[model samples]
Target chain A: MNTVSTSPYLAGLLQGQPPASPLTWLNELRANAVDRVGALTVPTTRDEDWRFTDISPLTKLSFQPAQGAAQLAPAAIEQWAIPEAAARLVFVDGIYAPGHSFNRAGLTVENLASGVSRHGAAVQAHLGRYADFERNVFTAVNTAFLHDGALILVPRDTALAAPVHLLFIATRKHAASYPRCLIVAESGSAVTVVEDYVALQSEAYFTSAVTELALTGNAEVHHVRVQREGAEAFHFANCAVSLAQASRYHSVSIALGGRISRHNLAALLAAEGAECRLDGLALIGGQQLADSHTLIDHASPRGSSRQLHKCIVDGAARAVFNGNIMVRPGAQRTDSSQSSRNLLLSARARVDTKPQLEIFADDVKCAHGATVGQLDVDEVFYLKSRGLSDTAARNLLTYAFGAEVIERIPVASLRNRLEQTVMERTHAAAPGAEGKP
Target chain B: MIYQDSKTLLSVRDLHASVSGTRILKGMNLTVKSGEVHAIMGPNGSGKSTFAKVLAGHPSYEVSGGEIEFEGRNLLELAAEARARAGVFLGFQYPIEIPGVANSQFLRLAYNTVQAGRGEDELDPLEFDDFVREKMKLLEMNPDFLDRSVNEGFSGGEKKRNEILQMALLEPRLAILDETDSGLDIDALRIVAGGVNQLANKDNAIVLVTHYQRLLNYIVPDYVHVMDAGRIVKTGGKELALELEERGYDWVGAEAKANARVNA
Candidate 1:
């Protein structure tokens, strides 16, 4: 535990390490990121976003950077692989697994380590460009550590026919992994990226991830970050997406595992005529906790944004959803709406959801609502009267509660996988169980 | 006491029930036999719906004093699902719409439950699918209807048709059609009644509870019982429904109260 003095040990690991790249341009950004990380601190209950989700587990966990020349066996890779992905990028213990990545042309996919070691120029231009590190301590810490992650660049006017799947697996217990991702969809380009943060081992673990995306002018990007870590693990992530003129951005955040988890997601509709849609679902059980904090900024005129988040909590589990949508002045016709619905499956289960909307533009249409309730009794009785047992009744109602959001995922096989995982957790009243399809 | 015979399918003796401490069904008595259909008709606020709801074991309704025996087994001792498993089906006047449970899924569950209760192995998904498809075709229902949520967006006639479809699947020993024809067009009435007529077998009984006599023209009942002020006051053959439709409920109510006073 003493080895884990700070949130992440990457900064200390690279303190005296020699630069493998010919250029030293990124050194300045690295120093700046470290300074930013040094300045910010983990939040407490006093902070608005950290009000419901407890951060003690994160502060107490022991973390160490992955050592050099550690090989993840092929059998382990095959057992936990995402076969449905068009392209797969594997990161084990926060280090890029060399033989595990499958890259193709018209789409540039590579490990952040290779780009930083060999191609410093391209790495310096985009790293830590889209996130606001100062506002979130976890995001700043990830940037400072930033050892390795997946970097995907979609060339201008090029649209990938399939989804690029990024997988980060936690293979060591009582250890921390920092997986950073940056996706750039160039002008007139279209691409979809699915980032999965999964725990390969059942032992206790902590994973802090940062994913940044930028959609260039007239570009369309769909990004989904699904975290289904093992129980006895602490998961934290920060996702930021920015849209340019006439570009479209859609994101779905699903938090279904981890003993303690929190997600910080922010989207900026900065270009005129751009559209942004954000949806999320969180299924929590056991002593597990999942909290999501989202902010949407409608900065330009005629841009629209919509957000919907649903949460289901059972057992002694707790869930939190805090969403804010801001329509700035002169951002007229910025249609934005946000809503959060929660279902408490047990008397001990709890949910705290808040939807905040700030509309400086009088002409903008912005509305928000939040609801926390148990399963509808009449609905339960109706199903039970039809011969379904009580468990079946509650399970059906809870599945429906989250199905509306899961259905919007647009990935059939992926949605089915998440639905199965959620159903299994629904029965055990705990995270990290297997579900029957 | 009514239907003092072992051949009776459903027997009620001075049945009394209440909701929220307020008694609704006071001394209601009725009986039915296999192969015969009975229609209980009454005016509004006459506790006509209470008898149907009580038999279905609605939690809100308390059975204060009653002996409801279905196939010689005590009905009040069972829960709603138990009563359903015991082969007593209630076609709700206004069926509740369950948003997430799919129509075919709910029907399969109901069918498997009844089958299991009768000591039969539950049909697997493929077998259940085949079974449901055949039943849907028999009722002239579209195959796509099974994919939708249970009556989530069903029309009035569609809801009634769905009820009859369930009846055909479960093959209950006693079917309680609670105002099944209240919200239907003449065409919908014929289709729904046709489905119900096809499902009623000689081994099962049908209790059609309605206010109007029009539905009787399609699925004619063996007997019509006139209920007023929480008790059945008149019992006659099928023609009784037509006579009451013409004479109105006012005369029946006046005659029932007068007869009670004379007996007192």
Candidate 2:
């Protein structure tokens, strides 16, 4: 394999790394990731995996690693606080902010820096194992700088009544932040986790995040990820999930910000009778671009998976969705269905959607469908005939298109906040507001 | 009932319209006065539904040549929503299914929009809920429908009732019902027609565009006009609907053609 040439852009991003961790395995993991980053180059349109999403804008600008955590007041982040969260961990610029965080769940929910010292074996066994960075430059870069992250471990047969919130806030421009998260749900345990990313300013920045989730036998994990970066930010995230026997994983990811953002999620049903449900929504406007790639691997018998992804693009924006479902040769009775629905609100808006299925097992059932369209003319006229203006009708339909996916989010307060945000974004991108009749 | 002294609500003169460059309405002319119900009967492609859509200013239909005056103003200048706000309502033949938008929310918006247009007080959600629940009783709609998406997964009868429910909420000065009886059972037809009858008054007019006389039996019309090809070809009283229903529409088309040849 050719592992010699690394682009100057990748070299520039590898500038300021934190000192080596005291843990030997952790340091070794970082060293391997740095070598991998040196081997992989930035992906371009020529790459089959990134044929539609061009990240040249991210490589055009140079970003430095964040120096220190920003001192933030608890009141500043009060708006994003979840009342139903049993524990909360706040990270500013990829560094844990102890002043704005609290842990009351009596579980192992803390910063990875300290959690590693306490639970080194569990962290070492699962950290760099699931999210493989052999060919993924973004994931390699994230792993190379994975010093601070959120770590949660649910004990066996324990069920938490409330969710755990992991909030990452970006407060500086021209700064590169690698946000990492690793959650381990033991056998028969149940937990909900929210990995949220938000920005305080509208300036160019870079965020490469990697998250790994491991569900043990009969364990249930509800993952809700929200990426609300600034309008001029670049965000790339990789999430890997492994489901054991009879485990259930439900994930809902919403992308509403970032000038260019891409999220890659891979879920492996490694044991029999495992189930997963993946729901996603991207509501973008004003020249923004969002891409989502997901892979569901049915490695064992009786594994079932369902996925529904939607995108509402307006004002010259573009959205892309690629979903892949694979049923292995010996995986009998592996049922899977996936749908990618996109709505273009303006004439210049565009969407690239593909829902693919690869089934090798004769007894497996798999179905996939993709649709890219604009607001239905009949639906718009139906609303207008009820005395709603053209703008109101268009905005309402756009909001409804996204609400279907947002409703799947398990948290009530978060769901309400996202619903409100979707409504406001649709109105702001309306033709009437833009002075177009 | 036709009152001679009633004010004229709508006057159309040589209204010509088309869809996708194919003319559907060919020089249609009609005049509607308040406190009167006019039934425009015709075959499937006779432009009855096209007339209703044109009146509502549907974007698909292009008005190539026409003059539409409503309340002594140029009606064609206003948009669909503007026309709706100005007291013109079109009950669609196929009630649209708007998923994710609750029925209560849609009804409240339409009601408040027309209310605002008339410089009247608008009701808040709580007040609107109470007011709309009373109106729903007129159509015998279940209260659970208010929470469901607008017309989504609704039965044929339920969709028809929802359309009439909107008619009750808006209380428009002119309502053109286009084939509203096509997908309804006898019980639903009676309920929908009863709701329409309650909404009628001396200040408003109703136009029923239908293919059958079954709807005319419930909400009787003062004038029944037979339309063929595009324009109205024959005019008579309410009995004309029964006559055409019994004799079929071929005779009327032949008689109109014979008359056209004589005039030529």
Candidate 3:
């Protein structure tokens, strides 16, 4: 880790007075966050949590908050939108672009800044409650710039007919944007939210994003985030979720972009019988590096969770996956399983996956495993024997390895879109890098 | 060597091959014309499987010095996929498991590739699904196999049937079966052989590479060739297979040694 990127404070991001807000409480919340950002620094290699990922590039630059939504041609973002989404929100450069967004009935989807403008007490109770900024600096940065993002709330007993797609587009060079999202699913409600991050060009930018999801009793949420930023961009994202009694949460994070990207995913099971499934897939190649750090905390009795995180490394790229499942005291009857499957496509591509289970509850069923491998030679031979070229065979096999985890997503349209993305990318999941056609 | 004709589908002359610096096929020779069924029988380590893989241009074995002609073209110069596109098929003894690619997708890609190579119209997914289902009935393979991954969880017999299914779909001019009947039960053998029999015509040829004569009883061969120490020592009619089965292979090995010494 370089010393410059590891520094704790980055100046000149505040610009001016916090924001023009009617609510003093929200303004005070933002004020406290700026103070927190000044105190908490970027996690360094000495920090056990960030041992494998180096954020030196992030420390060297000072970024200004993106100005406003820029007008892009219609055809650019149309490819990323699925018609199946009931409500679609488009944010260009971390600011909502109304011209490119759509919303359906029976659901409330508004910009975070708009939600704060109305000054409703309901938004006040849920916002910033699930994410903690005492230890994480990125969360504080997002909180300091919390006037914009996607604000969603699902009412009780309403099962959404279609998902809400939040599309975040990063553009411009040497600019920084803090994208925040708050999803509060009321009791007995079911919803799915997709966070899609894309880039139109290979210009360098910084996207410090945070999302807080709170699921009440008997609520269900399926959260999927796709990160496909440009190869030169930087992405730092954190998702903190809390589940109530009998609530279920499932999340799949696909990271496939940026020069240096790290996703911090943590879930808390706070009530009995709450179930969760945490899955992730990262595709890194060239000189890029992506890291996924996950923590699942079981605080109540009879809670269960299952996790499978996988990464495919190609070229000289590197990937890191750290998954920890904790069964706290008095959390009996906890059933959790975690596995990390890493595939190395070249001699230089590498992965560091650590699956840990810290159990304080004596009577619990917990299992964790980790594996790193390459494509099977016999399988490749078989594909080649059937008239497939060497490159096609290797690509097909590499796509399948990622598909094993991606196919777990139940939504057909979402699953198919992701399948297309993985297939279209480079098939560097084979051993040798030289002489590949 | 068998006499070559205008109807010849494959012609092999003085073929030599080795793997990892060790010679496996040394000056082996054979010739097969369309409409003919030839069976090559040999004991362990005689390179019957190696010859089949070499025909399909497997990357493992290098043709040190030899010649292989298929369909009036030099076979060794083509890549494995190019050979498949040019109508050469090899049935592996051990089918590999591909865990996530659907069987139907695999079959269609191969079928369309060969069709494209021949300048024929390619079938779309829906059309290929119907065509593949019809072919599946010949092997009694369940329709569910189309949705599952290729040979991932299939039984040993099912894997062989899949190989034959590919052979049937591609409609290769020369089909080589390497121990396809090694692990099949009696019933499976009849079904698979029956499928093979239906596929044989005057436009293509079939080569059965096997260890036991039991398979020959189902799909009788026109010529039976005895391979020993990487060379064909004897070539006779189909009845020669039964004779070898009865008399065993030691006498044949000894006779070849005696003949070699006499020639020297």
Candidate 4:
């Protein structure tokens, strides 16, 4: 168990002490990752993925090591908790809130800090294995100060009846929330995890988070990320997943808020006959900006990956979508597809899309496509003629655009919650609530 | 009021329109007053549908030389949505399928847009649901149809009924039923025609554009105009539709070619 403290350095030292000689390599890796975070500059308008989205808001924040010491008002975390989750982990200002958590059998949900302090071997072995810190600065930073995340471990052949919910709340006082998560499903295990990051208040803050997931052979895993930060909040999150032979992985990311936000996800099909699906939907309004970049690597033969990402941009908001699929050599019969679509609701709204495919294997079926467009007038007319007002019609069309991704989500309740979030965000972006449900 | 019973709902004089540099409606002329139902009967490619689309301000159709007035206001000046707001509705021959737009939500937006254009407050979802439920009843449409996406996965009959449901809700001053019967089965035609009849008040006019006189049997028009070679060659009463159906379109075409030769 971790001793709660306000000093970030003391908290870091108490949390970072390695257990024994056997775990020295991982501790060293964590130190190196921290150095990388310090060396590498946070992305700005200069980077391709960060072009349309400005990180100036993030750079202005004086990020502190949030040591899970801040107290949240009664019933605050409950308002954002997933009601049907079998197990729930709540984090307030990047620190675990033990009193707000729900317990479950055959499942262990602990803060990364405590996991490192207690279950050091298990925590250190798989903490940063899946995530590639070299490719992303935020991931490196998360690894360096990876003390505030939730670790979920599902033992072999355990099929959880309900999803595990992880809630991270970024409050105005905390100013910054750095969240790191690790979910490992052993062979033949089945589990669903919903990771939600929300702003507790409408104030300027930053959330830098990382989630690393692994699926052993034949394990089925479902993961969903719902980011509903405040209008003045800056959010950066990355998820890296590794799939073993015959394992199935389904992941969906919904980014609908924040002033400046970025989501980077990478899925590696490491063994033969693995299945990976990455789906995302984003709704942006006001002067908000959101950037999403994804990569699906077919590292072995007989692997399949499908990626679909959709964005709705309204007001003067901006969005950027980058999807890439890599088919390495000898990865035969690798069926992979990637598509990114953007619908601009306002004339001032803008979207930049890039879909690329690199296929080194000749026997692979790989395709990538990207499209950016305004709502089709004819399509709008079709709806308006049915007696919907212009604003209502546009909102319906926008919801429908994002629904394609929401429908693919395995959990119905989470999907419904996300639908409401998307509708609310869209209404805020649009002129009126004429068509909102 | 969105309509005046004694005034002309639609008036076109020497109207010309083209798409992609190809002329479609060449000097077409027509007029319809509120409370009147007029059917424009013509063969394919005779510009019957173009007249309807141009009146609705389809983006691709260029109104090169035309004067269109609806209830004394210049129709050609309004954009498609403005025209819609100004009480002009066009039932597309091929209704586009908008994948994500719900059938119910689309109807509400259209109704509210028209209301807002007429200087009225917009209806919220709760109010619009009641409004649409009442209209759907007249069309004999199931309540579930409102939850589906616009025109997506709809059968031919369902699409036609959906169009009529829209016409009933918006209550346009002049409803251009462009090939509304093109892809309907007998059951769909009856339901669609029934819906039109329920909404057809004495204050609004209807313009039915079709190639066949089949739909005329369900909803008889007050007048019928025979168009050929981009121009109307003849106009008569409802009996004209029966006559054209019995005699075929050769007589109208022959007369049109004769007029073209004389003009040339």
Q: State which candidate has the highest DockQ.
A: 2
Q: Write the per-residue lDDT of candidate 4 for residues B1-264, one digit (tens) a residue.
A: 124436777789998889889898888889888888889998888999878878887767898997998888998887677788888899888888866557776677677667777888878888888888988899888999988877889998888888888888788888999999988888888889888877787789899999999999988898899888677889988899989999999987887788779999
**Residue B36's C-alpha lDDT in candidate 1?**
81
Model 2 Cα lDDT, one tens digit per residue, A170-191: 9999999998899999999999
**TM-score (C-alpha, index-matched) for candidate 3:** 0.83
What is the C-alpha lDDT profile of model 1 across A257-370, one tens digit per residue? 898888888888888988988999998877989999898988999998888898988789999888988888889988888889888878998988888888888888887888
| DockQ agreement of candidate 1 with the native complex | 0.39
Looking at candidate 1 chain B, the ten consecutive residues that score lowest on lDDT are B1-10
lDDT of 3 by residue, A285-375 (tens): 9989999999999999999999989998988999999998999999999999999999898899999988888999999999999999987
Comparing 2 with 3 on lDDT, the higher-scoring candidate is: 2
Off by over 4 Å in 2: A1-5, A22-24, A156-161, A332-335, A363-366, A431-437, B243-247
Q: Write the per-residue lDDT of candidate 1 for residues B100-205, one digit (tens) a residue.
A: 5578877887788778777877887889899888987766888888989888899998888898888898888888998999889999899988888888777888
TM-score of each: 0.88, 0.92, 0.83, 0.82
Q: Sort all candidates by DockQ, best to worst.
A: 2, 1, 3, 4
lDDT of 2: 0.91
lDDT of every predicted structure (CA atoms)? 0.79, 0.91, 0.85, 0.80
Ranking by TM-score: 2, 1, 3, 4
Model 1 chain A: ten consecutive residues of lowest lDDT: A1-10
For candidate 4, the clash count comes to 15
